[model samples]
Target: MDAGAGRIGRALGPGRRRRERPEVTLTNYEAVYDFYGPGRRRDGFTHPLLTFVGALYAPEVRIRPETVTELHRLHDAGVGIIVAANHPSHHDPFVLASAVYDRRVRFLASGTGLTKDPLFRGPLRPVFEYTGTVPVFRAKNYEGTERAVHDAAAARLIGLCVDRLTAGGVVLTFVEGTNSSADDLRTLRLDSVKKGVGQMVRGVRDTGGRVAVLPIGIVYRGRELAKLPPRRPVVSAGPLALWEDPGPAPSVDEVRHAVRAGIDDALTDAWG
Candidate 1:
């Protein structure tokens, strides 16, 4: 068992037993890609599982009222939204889902999150699959031919997100690409926002579809170390920044700057 799980298991004491790790059938990247490909059917029926887990772990979530109103307005207007948020813990996805349950946003998740562990592969995989979560394979996780395969898969996933945006769907992504320590929360400077956000925006612009990026800041209260299932994390949403192309499309750096500014504003709200 991983150290984190081991600690939780010990904390459960003799009275509570850890559930047996379920058997995982999808073990390879090809299998995972085939199963979670964009063409597959996703009913989003398992989305409530995110809410259930979020409530169980972060029951006292606080969200800005105005932010909720703004999100509703955007959704009602049929605007494609890309929810950009900082990733401090694995629990951020669930907590954010609980905070914005009404949006019914699809998550852009790492491929490894689905197939890395038995627990994820068995029980939790369905939640992602059925909830329309887009799994992206990182080439860094593989080598040689495997790396090339992942690279192609990642490209295809980007296209899928672009298509979703063009179709006026809501997609949530962690702009930082990787989780950062909560200790850095005070600094307020996010890890360099990845180029993927810019690429997605460019893709949408290329299609001449209207899309906006919504920045969400997640702050964990009284967190000294990175822990699973944070305690009472606060989610703050900033105003939506629309990226439209009337002439030449905005450069990737420009998009990145806008996203960064939006995230900064949301972070300020979260800390305030």
Candidate 2:
């Protein structure tokens, strides 16, 4: 592997796969499903869009130097990076975006929230796919939606993410599957990682790609209950587990639990 200079390749290259249907918005769920396939869209706009996103959130958070270094290290190695992070608030996407502004990153977004939540149906609707966010279906989606629909959508979404990482991209996801809704921001439930992380790891390995997991802790003070807003929240990347050649394939459940442990340990250490 050409593990070198990850900081050098932040711009989007040609033939980026994800896209949106400007003609038919997310409200038209049928159109969305049709338009949301692999290699269907382009990233001609993501670089600049990310620049704006990073700048917008820069003032709200302080990314740790070591975390930035870790990102660069993983990218330089030219290996797929899966960032399993905590979800404290909706603002996390912005904060995390700002932290990894220099890397080719994608956020795993919630299809359920987008399709079901009234707030996202407006201007925010486009935001889901605008900045390279990957929408995923889960059992947690809209009521009455068939399990088969989510199953099919999730399978396709996972394939798309695997392809992106196979091409040596960085993907960030909240391990808890959704925001913690915690009373404060000091601690998080890292043990509660969703199923995607393990799926990604196995997919990368199965598809002839090297992958690694980074346990990142979002640390800050002064949330809604405090005297100030999160003027200097921190995104700290640490306690990583790089790709290793396991003699034989491990079950998805095993990979999931191992990742959970790594993330939980990292978060616990950071929280203290």
Candidate 3:
């Protein structure tokens, strides 16, 4: 086995077979690197680069500054939190990160976005590293070259790094797992949710870690939350509810409802 294969073998274990997805073509590696590489290094500086760009480039979106201001307020109140929100658009991550800028939370992401040749990886991976962003491996299913990368991640358990992030501090996750074009939220693939978040919450419960799950709502009214024609964004933060001790790990339904509820409440207030 090569170095990468050796890595994944240890982390993900030997039981599962690798699967392939046509939608996720690897040929666009250059395109991905060109676009996402530089931003990775700039992720931590000055209000998260994307948020600043969105605000400047898409000023018409119109999200009240007060929404983020409220998030800061909660941070000041001393809450160790994990924020879960709906991923309606590509910009959702930036908008969500901006909402909690005052808190300085780390993000957990899929490894597929970061793995690459060293020349490209160096500049592109640091922002993820700086912000405590850890990667979850998605390459375990391939029998050939992809399997090699999967094995690398599995060996390091970089995919399981969410457990470490949750143990260390707050980590944000997009429970939906992927971005959606429609405003209507999709069903949480309970299995995916279980693997990432369930493991985090369960780990804390089994051992000991300060984990507070918080539901946040971002209301992008009118053209505020657009990714295509770029628009101004409006975001709202909801009051947090902590899960009880030994409380069951939140189900996909539970989390979705909470997040959706928060979003609904936020939209109501922002529009009204």
Q: Say which candidate scores most in lDDT.
A: 1
Q: Any runs in candidate 3 off by more than 4 Å, and if so which?
A: 1-79, 102-130, 138-168, 181-195, 222-229, 244-272
Specify the poorest-scoring 10-residue window by lDDT in model 3.
108-117
Which has the higher TM-score value, candidate number 1 or candidate number 2? Answer: 1
User: CA lDDT of each candidate?
Assistant: 0.62, 0.57, 0.45
Comparing candidate 1 with candidate 2, which one achieves the higher lDDT? 1
Q: 1 or 3: which has the higher lDDT?
A: 1
Q: Model 3 Cα displacement at 41 (Å)?
A: 8.3
RMSD (CA, angstroms), candidate 2: 9.6
For candidate 3, lDDT tens digit of each residue in 100-133?
5433332322111222123234564444444434
Question: Where's the lowest-lDDT run of ten residues in candidate 1?
Answer: 108-117
Which order, best to worst by lDDT?
Answer: 1, 2, 3
**Clash pairs of candidate 1?**
none
Top TM-score model: 1
